[model samples]
Target chain A: MKLPADVVSKKNGKHTIQPLSDPKIEAKDLDFFYSEKKALSDVTITIPSNRVTGLIGPSGCGKSTFLRCLNRMNDIIPGTRVQGKILLDGQDIYAPDMDVVQLRCRVGMVFQKSNPFPKSIYDNVAYGLRVNGWKDRREIEAKVEQSLRHAAIWEEVKDRLKSSALDLSGGQQQRLCIARALAIQPEVLLMDEPASALDPIATARIEDLIQELKKDYTIVIVTHNMQQAARVSDFTAFFYLGQIIEFDRTEVIFTNPRQQRTEDYVTGRFG
Target chain B: MRLLPKSFKANKRERGIELFLLFCASVSILTTLGIVAVLLFETVDFFREVSIVSFFTDTEWTPLFAQKRFGIWPLLIGTILISGIAMLVALPAGLLSSLYLSEYAPDRVRRVVKPVLEILAGIPTVVYGYFALLFVTPLLQKFLPGLSGFNALSPGIVMGIMILPLVSSLSEDAMQAVPRSLREGAYALGSTNLQVSFRIVIPAAFSGITASFILAVSRAIGETMIVAIAAGQQPRLTANPLVPIETMTAYIVQVSMGDTPVGTLEYKTIFVVGMMLFLSTLVLNVLSQRLRARFREVYR
Candidate 1:
């Protein structure tokens, strides 16, 4: 768990690169395209292990798109193309021999709208394990219970394991989705504005769960609220248009960013 | 009547228009009631001559013979046999086409294929009957030398092809209406295309698919022209689809074409058979509606 040495930069306007404590994922010189239109350009960043990293920007700034690139979720969208390297533990995920399904098993995602399967609460949590070829019924039940407990929703839904997930309230549904993602025991969890559709109370609960989840899973969250980013993230990256304006510790990004655009965005000058 | 308060006031013209719309809505209901009344009145007269027990239990259906026999089973069995053959052809073709159209086919391919499939439904059923008599029957006779000139097999296959669009189109709509988020959710769990389409998408849309299947079967039961033209007018109780047999609708058409007296027992038989067909379809439609309501609570 040693921090990598800082790489000195010659660019005067950009912030100097800082060292990271054991980077778990890295994107280098990445370029993304949706058909003919360019969406992201030469983006590069390191995601540290056992920490929550927040990506903050206004609408259509490619924050969610960037999050999806980590696990190749963007590949599902037709005619979209990617040109860059995304590495997980020194192995390139986009390599020709790499198995995308295996990569997705190791890295799970929660959508912004909390898309739970229209199944029972128990089955929803056990879906990943079943799909990955788990056959033992006892083991599946145990893992489902453990994942639900980990997501902090087991107590509320323990009595209704066989009930449809849709019967639960909105916050419970989002938690059930998190439990489903966790059931696969993924090492990395990607959250795409997981609280945007929830109420203030539900949003607070999700924030707390995110803080608890970082101890076991490397978390990367995309959000529109700068205050929420500061509240939940250890590291913050500010994106503008199609590039990262600044990437640094959460405290530095909020209080004293080197880039003028980062300052304008953080200080509420303009989105 | 007392004058209403300002907030509760109703405009006279608006009330008139509302009453007119209500009347328009009741027209179909009134027509259905009128049909039921006529069927009941004729069915009572029919039972007076042909005993109710003999109509259901007797196996022979020769009402025009010197020694008359009245059994409904022969006609009912014929109807079931033709419909069964039609379903055997229609179900797999319809389901596979819908799965491909919804899950596997690209947008350009769907655009080119869907309308072409629906054209089968738009073609007149009488034209389908002619096709059975002219093309499909001859093709079958070549393979099976024992095939009859006018057998249930030809009309059954033709009717199956005719209803392909109904089954495929309805099933495809049901599958397509499944939210994209569910597909994404399955993919996020590392499922392949086949797994997502079959395990997640199909199960989620099962109610709608079942309803469409039942509706298609009802349509097959009600088809007349194709069976009448190709299937010979001989009421037999056999299950062999290769033989010529008259379905209930075909029998109705057969009697209607002749110059039988309006109120005779020969003419009253049509009403009784028609009542049975209507009742079966009504039961099927009600079951389909119930299934549709049960599983929709999951998504909506």
Candidate 2:
């Protein structure tokens, strides 16, 4: 199927088509609201298959709200109203025929703070599988191991499957969250400042993990740290006050922004 | 001279009031200590008269009468049976109610449901006893066989209902304390509301839940009027709750019904039984406190 150009990827250092050649998700004129206040305004963006795209802005610029709109996570918030179109795999997701449960399975998310369940590491990863109806003990174990391996946390946690996930180091716990998401094998992974909760070293590990994971899954990350975004993302979208002021390859957006507001914000003149 | 010439130089009357308040505070603490000391002394005295084995294992509980048998098992078993029933009914319903309040119920529904449940707590135990005797016993008799007018089932069920607010309120606080970030994390992974609550939030808040549970159980044990009025003072050692049984508090009330001469072994039984109840709750309270201390996250 011919896919609309992922407008978010028009920025520099923006990578090429997926080896599979199909866009996983597309959003057209997407608007989001929390009661009377609009959090996202006419923002159209696309999440390409198997690439790391970063959304950067200051607090409440609607980056997180937009990310939430991708998987319908904002629906739980009282008075949250969303409009326009969100598509997954050339199918219009907002078209009333969508199944939210299947949409969530196909697209997963991680958060700013590392939230490893208080149970054993094995159970934490095993949770999503069980909910999706995986019943066999052997299959659950193998899947947990496989997911942890994909998140690059398997070797460290292999000997301690029964140990509480909370007992792991902060970096490891963040990776465990990734593994838990990976356990469901989603097509798109949305991360909202997944590294902000970590120390520098831990942040570096997560950055590396994100870079590696993009080869197999699409990644959309929201970060306030411009350097981290420039370093890790293949493409970057700079959002300001509920608008995508500029979006392009990371190099172009940094060295040669098309919009003046994007340059001033990039240079720390005004947020 | 310099040390004495501090800020209160012009406030002698205030100083006197401060000293008086300090004295009152000390007196309150001392009064508590004095009461504990008295209970301890009398309890030890009673233990000397009644062997520990007899206190724990005796099946009959009459002490003031000529046929006085001091085996405390009847009262102990009765207390356990009622508390057991209370916990059995309270735990699941209370936890689920808390989960719904925290996770599922809408704000408007929560405002209504929460107060409705807490209203259970506001009604006096005596009122609960009356309701148990007058209403619950009759209702239970339709389905349950041999459920006497003052069977343990009515009182225990009423006590369980009475403690619902305690369990729901506390467990809700515990679940709330599990951190919204943890819940957000669970949801980002595509977890359902129940999955996020039961798997992540509940276990993360386990210590608080444990503390809440122990507190509920203690409340159930210490409850008296309902059992006294609804569960007759039979003092049986059986778990057949459909029949009447006399709990320890009810036994104390039974002895106190008429003048059991003070300082007699009969009057002293009150103190001994009181000590046992006190000690049991004390241990559970301490355990709950320690569990909360060890597991509570210090969020900076």
Most DockQ-accurate candidate: 1
TM-score of each: 0.91, 0.90
lDDT of 1 at B266: 89
Q: Which portions of model 2 show Cα errors greater than 4 Å?
A: A1-22, A95-97, B1-22, B298-300
- What lDDT does candidate 2 reach at residue B47? 86
Docking class of 2: medium
Candidate 2 CA-lDDT value: 0.84
Compared with the real two-chain complex, what DockQ does model 2 have? 0.56
Superposition error at B1 for model 2 (Å)? 12
DockQ of each: 0.58, 0.56
lDDT of 1 by residue, A172-267 (tens): 999999999999989999999999999999999999999999999999999988889999998889888878888887888899888898999999
TM-score (chain A only) for the predictions, listed in order: 0.93, 0.91
C-alpha RMSD values across all candidates:
5.0, 3.6
Report the poorest 10 consecutive residues by lDDT, candidate 1 chain A: A1-10
Local accuracy of candidate 2 as per-residue lDDT tens digits, A81-183 = 9888988888887778887778889889987778877778998899888878899999899899999999998999999999888789888998999999999
